[model samples]
Target: MSLQALWNQFLADPGRILNDLALFFTLAGAWLLLATRRREQRATARLVPQNEAQAVALDESTARMNRFFYRFGYGCLMLALLVSWYSTRL
Candidate 1:
C-alpha cells in the first residue's frame, strides 16, 4: 500500500490510537513513580544508622517494595499488550 493509504487506514481507527497513547502514558507514569520511590528510599536509608534494627526493617521494606513494583509493573505491561492486540483486531 502507498503511504497515503497507510495514513488513511491509521486515521480510520481513532480508538486504537487513543488507547495506545493512554498505555504509553500509564507506563511512563509507572516508571516515574518507581524511580521516585527508589530515590526516596536510598536517601532515607542513608539517614538510618547501620547498627539499628530500624535499618534492617527499612532494608526489608525496600526489598518488598521493589518486588511488588516489579510484579505490578509487569502486570500493567501485560494488560497494555492485551489491550493493544485487541484494539488492532477490532
Candidate 2:
C-alpha cells in the first residue's frame, strides 16, 4: 500500500492505534524496569545496624513493593496485548 493509504487506514481506527502504542510502551517500560531493578539499593538504605526488627520489616516491605511492581507491570502488558488483539480482530 501507498504511504498515504497506510496513514488513512491507521487513522480509521484510533482505538487500534492507541492500543498498539500502549502495548509497546508498557512492555518497553516493564522490560527496562526488570532489567535494572535494584532491591539491594533500596534495602540497604532502610536497614539499620542498631535496629534489627526495623531492618527486617524494611526488607520485607521493600520485597513486597518490588513484587507488586513486577505484577503490575506484567498485568499492564497482558492488558495491552488483549486490547490490541481484540481491537485488530474486530
Q: Per-residue lDDT for 16 in model 1?
A: 71
Candidate 1 per-residue lDDT over residues 23-89, each given as its tens digit: 8856865895688578767856776665556544445776687667677776766767776766777
Judged by TM-score, which candidate is best? 2
Task: Count clashes in each candidate, considering only residues at least 3 apart in sequence or on different chains.
Answer: 0, 0
TM per model?
0.49, 0.51
Q: Tens-digit lDDT track for model 2 on 1-90? A: 899987897789867776777778577757846753665455565565657675355556667877777777677777777777767775
Q: After superposition, how far is residue 42 of candidate 2 from its true place, in Å?
A: 7.1
Worst 10 residues of 2 by lDDT: 35-44
| Deviating ranges (above 4 Å) for candidate 1 | 1-14, 25-58
Model 2 alpha-carbon drift over 4 Å, by segment: 1-11, 24-32, 39-58
Q: Model 2 residue 63 lDDT? A: 70
